[model samples]
Target: MKRQHSMPFGAEAVHGGGVRFRLWAPGVATITLQLDGDQELPMTAADGGWFELTVASAQAGSRYLFRLPDGLLVPDPVSRFNPDDIHGASEVVAPTAFDWSDGDWRGRPWHEAVIYELHLGSFTASGDFAGAIERLDYLVELGVTAIEIMPVADFPGRCNWGYDGVLPFAPDAAYGRPEDFKRLIDAAHQRGLMVLLDVVYNHFGPEGNYLHAYAPDFFNPRHATPWGAAINFDGEGSRVVRDFFVHNVLYWLEEFHLDGLRLDAIHAICDDSTPDIIEELAAAFKSVPGRARHVHMVLENERNQARYLTRDDFGRLLHGTAQWNDDIHHAFHVLATGESDGYYVDYAADPARLLGRCLTEGFAYQGEASTFAHGERRGEASAHLPPAAFINFLQNHDQIGNRAFGERLCHLASPLAMEAVTAVLLLAPQPPLLFMGEEFAAAQPFLFFCDFGPELAQAVTEGRRREFSRFARFADPAVRESIPDPNAPATFETCALDWSAIERAPHRAVLELHRQLLLLRHQWIVPRLAGMDNGDPRLAMPSARTLAITWRLGDGSLLALLANLGDDPVDATPPPGQLLFATANLDATTLARGRLPAWSVRWHLQPGDSR
Candidate 1:
């Protein structure tokens, strides 16, 4: 039988026989499969630089690697499981063998999504798939609709942020077997939680990246990314390269049954294709038949391209996608901490104005010349896009981990400021994302950590610390040695979230506060702001540090939230029917007194003048 055009690229499990192996090596003349340690089976050449061979003796979990002409063995680029890491044999996996319990769990709508981003390695004390699975209930109770897991691609070594993965098709062996991750996702889906994986497509990691060794055309040497060679999307032999990436997308969604994928650093993806690689990828994802629910795909484009969410006049670009709202985070960080340097300088210069604009205009630098980028215009006006297209977050992996010490917002900013910003984030019309341990205000720092060879490791350490030299923290002579080495096991170990912290005093308070805000978001705010534009959500900054956003509900109820983000006291008169919520001391009677305490968030509601 001819292979199904989309039946994945590597190994296929035969129904009554064994495993059929497929290898794409257009450049190589002859290919041999080293099977079951000793037996060598020569593969027959097929179309499109493809070679295939079926060994009836080889069963599921059997390991093998393709042998090159010079006699070097390499794991399958599209292997579902690499039992012995990247340098070892790739195991034949039957993706359909697992019993999934997420029956008919057609995921929630994007506007209703409250995403919690987590790194599986550092999210739990065990730092594995099962460890993360144990926390599913904790996350569900926290009222998050989506769990955006950090990248899980099999990279070199035991610990990593996962972006360095060369194997796009396999789960990291460090996180346990591929089935373990499936179990976690199944469990999450059983609880009505959507699982979204963060996928890196711009460039493969430097270490253990042998794609060039076999398929030298996989990467276009013409372009470069921060991570090194960019994936060839428009150059010669780019068609197959594009198919490889697009195939991975189909495999993740169809095989793993993941609810969605978050594309990482899409701005760094240098593709000159007419419709754009993203549009092509989106079309391929949507092409899968019998997709019941919305397959939510979000993007982290530094350019803040809202065009991804909507088609153009010529009916191009993918529509209904969400983009990360860095403007909101930058404005919040600057306004909350009052310490601005580096890229923060741009927003810090006019924080109040930028914060106001971020709330109202979507992107503060929308089509405006970026002073930080040396007069380069950044982003496009996306205020016309639905507010849900903008994902708001107070802290994400990049923001917290990029810092010299990886000190969380709670560590750097006042409790009041954090609380106020938290309220703003959850209450905003945009869908909100929470970093792992952020809800409980976990004290553990989320430092950048990785595991690489000694030589490359040293380079990473030196480069990481050097990048932070501009920061005031790294400037302190005492702090230079304190900068956590990215390559150290200790750095990876320390980033694990302390589950015990939730039992403590202020941490407990913060957790409860987060739960309440998230519940309020799902129940009241999201429904109220559903399909609402940025213009629908009204904002007022009474002072440089005080902000109030009012929403007129469809049910004729008015909801107003005021937050004081500064040390000084600020006041806002409540339009009272009742004071529904308050992050500080005050009640309906106190709210009626016409003043708000400094550094506080309060919600006031009047049943929309029921007359």
Candidate 2:
């Protein structure tokens, strides 16, 4: 093993701006600036162990590299504009050059947001930022207020899931470069859409990750993650590591103008500090100058700890925003499809549980036994939160693609069942999220993809097969071959949205249902659902199989959602409100009578519409 120096990244980038440059070098003492190959500027060091350089007109397109004190060269640690490839020197980009037309765009609240998670490559046949731009109009019409893009940070090769990103500042060369991404965001904002970036701070990808070569202790040996050594959050020189990540957050917000960040897998972050790394990052973002609503943090944490969303403990939430609500997805999937295999064991086939989780408690597994994990987890109940505290989704990259084989909700159930699921997802109290191609029930699967070097790629391929073989019936290696070869171009190509699906019948029906649901939510729901009670909105679970939700609007117009999670249809009259929305077709007589179909969701407006 080779010894590497840790570069102090914080000392250089945080200097109150005159184009001060910073790069982390743990193993080296001296560093030089390689400005476009010829000009070498000496970098000074702060007493706290960091290298810094100040340059004029250090905006965008200024190509530069860092020469380690020992003679090795590397990219800038805080390169806001990586016009060069990740493995190459850094290129500067002026964050302020792009004309932003969204200064007046008021954000959609977390409670009201319908998030559509997408990948730039797989989102369209073009598989680039430009290609994704073509579909923004479709998303806007679909009723989504925010578009959560998968990681755009640069990685090795042309295709990846972005968790393995090594260059935090650069957009993948495969995604048509940096300005293309800006086009997408600017276009999104122009259409009244907020963009949430999916950020991976837990670990970097395997290939093209040279951070260790420059900063050895960037990862701590005391704690370990499944991928590799954990980041040094509380260890020696860990303050610099914290600053590195905090800088990344601010860079994305300040440079890309991204509205928010979805921090990937916070539970795996394993920092045992008093003011946890997450809290520190959150506090830093919250404290940034002129960041009112432009920057926010959303966590994808498996821990059912409400503190991830609550403001009660540690004030972590003063900076934190919301977490991905897996419990809601679990309960809804179990109830609708009756699939109780993996984590679904914690859930039962009950609409009431699903409704209750979203309406009142915000999670189905708060202080409950998890059969899949075979443990008693989630010991406390977090009921006193707002509806916006959770981000609900039927299919995310993990849920649909991480299964034994990538299988979507559309594949697991019938068309009607899909419609019912979509109804609940949209009409639920919390905000809803749609995975890429989900609006039309896309046939393509979002397989786990990576662009590691050959050995790592082989390891990932074999590992994916072996991992899924344990619980899955697909034991044959031939069957495992269907798991998309992540590095292959097809992996990215296959995931693109087949807009033609919208013209098909079942897909069109589902698409129409989504459109209608969005209309109903914006037109009738947002006005009624506001404020916090003891918990979130109270989900009225009526029985082992029925969920009832009533939203009393500000104008006294009650909106109620009723769903039958059972296999058998339940014939019951809805509460005395006119039937405004129903997953299944309800004749006027049936609407008046209120007979709900099996596994169906219905929305009813309270009587006295004028009120």
**In candidate 2, where is summed lDDT lowest over 10 consecutive residues?**
1-10
Model 2: lDDT of residue 257: 68
Candidate lDDT values, in order: 0.81, 0.72
lDDT of 1 by residue, 176-241 (tens): 988898889888988989999999999888787776767878878788877667889999889888
Q: Which stretches of candidate 1 lie over 4 Å from their true place?
A: 1-8, 311-317, 472-478, 533-535, 551-559, 575-578, 585-590, 605-611
Candidate 1: residue pairs that collide: none
Backbone clashes counted, model 2: 21
lDDT of 2 by residue, 70-172 (tens): 6777776555445556768777654444666666654565556789998787788888889878888998898988999888888777777777787776677
**Quick one: best lDDT, which candidate?**
1
